[model samples]
Target: MTDVHRAIGTHGFERLLHHLVQLRASQINRCAYCIKMHTQEARRDGETPERLDRLIVWEQVDDFSEREKAALAWTEALTVLDGKADLGALRARLRAHFTDQEIGVLTSIVAMINLWNRIQVSRH
Candidate 1:
């Protein structure tokens, strides 16, 4: 996944956005370890305390950008697949902000974090 991160970073995926996606997915999965890890990493990378604190209610809050919202929405849709996930619409929204390759990278990031979240959550 480090390779995926590097690849995505090359495509303009900033560190803060990466942490945001990881944090959002971890939150959806209720993975305390990942949530803590990503939140700390985000802060270490200069993410504002206000944004980090408000990330749980990102949709209702006006703190995130359209791109961040799209990524977070995609992360949630992918993480909490309750058979009603609107993948097409989510992909469309992602496309509005990211290129096809970037979308692929974003999907990979979400999938990776979900995998980690499951592992971490299952351990407890």
Candidate 2:
């Protein structure tokens, strides 16, 4: 997992978006530890209080860019997946804002955070 983290870092994925993705996944999983840690890291890295506060309701807010929205949607889809996901539509939206590599990286980010959240959640 540590090595996977290092590889994801090499993609130059936007920092704030990366934090938001982590927060969104953590939020879905209700992982308190990750929520606290990620929010703190986001702030330390120059993310605003308003943005952090609004992240959970990002779909209704204008604080995020379209690209960020696409990523967040993907994060949610991956984190809270049911049997009826419309992955093709999600892929279309993602293509409008990201490269195939970026989508892959975003997928990895969601998967990793969900895994971490499960581990943290299980311990509690």
Candidate 3:
């Protein structure tokens, strides 16, 4: 984990946003390994264990902030590719809190984590 952290370093710690996105995406992908690993990591990074436990039910939980909810929603929409992503709506909501560049980075992080979750779970 340390080596992976060192390798991904700056880009990896760019924001808490990416990590949260990865956690949510992993849940959507149903990757138990990633869910366990990232949830622990997220807790180490100061995310509350209670919040982490409720992450899979984020939509139904009021513990997450508005920005986090929006990110989670976007992650799910994009991951499921349900063709129902209201990009304009999501963008408008996100733009209120995040820079365009931040949104781009988050989107990339979600996509990458989703791919990782699939590859990891497939190996089992």
Candidate 4:
């Protein structure tokens, strides 16, 4: 219900992509509430059970596309980085698959979810 959540709803990303970002951010932040909430929302939006089950272990799963893999990597790196690291390869992969604006929006979406996860986890 926050502005960030409202922006996500308006962003025009595919349902699967949106949920995938949410799931990745939730996992990074260790938010069980968000994990459960997004998983259920993802299912309702038609994400397959197999994919959802494999999300936490996405690197070990072969179900994800190359672009998705790159995006996931980018998501984690961005969330956890402490300083300037060479993200050139990941950036290239993302650029090849996503428009510049998509990359920007996706980054913000992950950041926003992570922010929410912190709030939700700390308060409860």
- Top TM-score hit: 2
Q: Kindly state the number of residue pairs that clash in model 2.
A: 0
Q: Give the TM-score of candidate 1.
A: 0.90
- Clashing residue pairs found in predicted model 4: none
The whole-model C-alpha lDDT of candidate 2 against the native structure comes to: 0.95
Once fitted onto the true fold, the runs of candidate 3 whose alpha carbons sit more than 4 angstroms away are 1-15
lDDT by residue for model 2 (1-124), tens: 9899999999999899999999999998999999999999999999999999999999999999999999999999999887799988989999999999999999999999999999999998
Give candidate 2 regions above 4 Å deviation: none
TM-score (all chains, Cα) for each model:
0.90, 0.98, 0.83, 0.89
lDDT of 1 at 98: 93
Model 1 residue runs over 4 Å out of place are: 1-12
Candidate 3 local lDDT, residue 61: 78
User: Ranking by lDDT, best first?
Assistant: 2, 1, 4, 3
- Residue-pair clashes per prediction, in order, are 0, 0, 0, 0
Q: 1-124 in candidate 3: lDDT tens per residue?
A: 4454444445543445566888889888889899888887887778887887788898897998888888888888778886666888987887887777767766766767877888998987
Superior candidate under TM-score, 2 versus 3: 2
Model number with the top lDDT: 2
Error of 4 at 17 (Å): 1.0
When 3 and 4 are scored with lDDT, the better candidate is 4
Q: How many backbone clashes does candidate 1 have?
A: 0
Give stretches of model 4 more than 4 Å off: 82-85
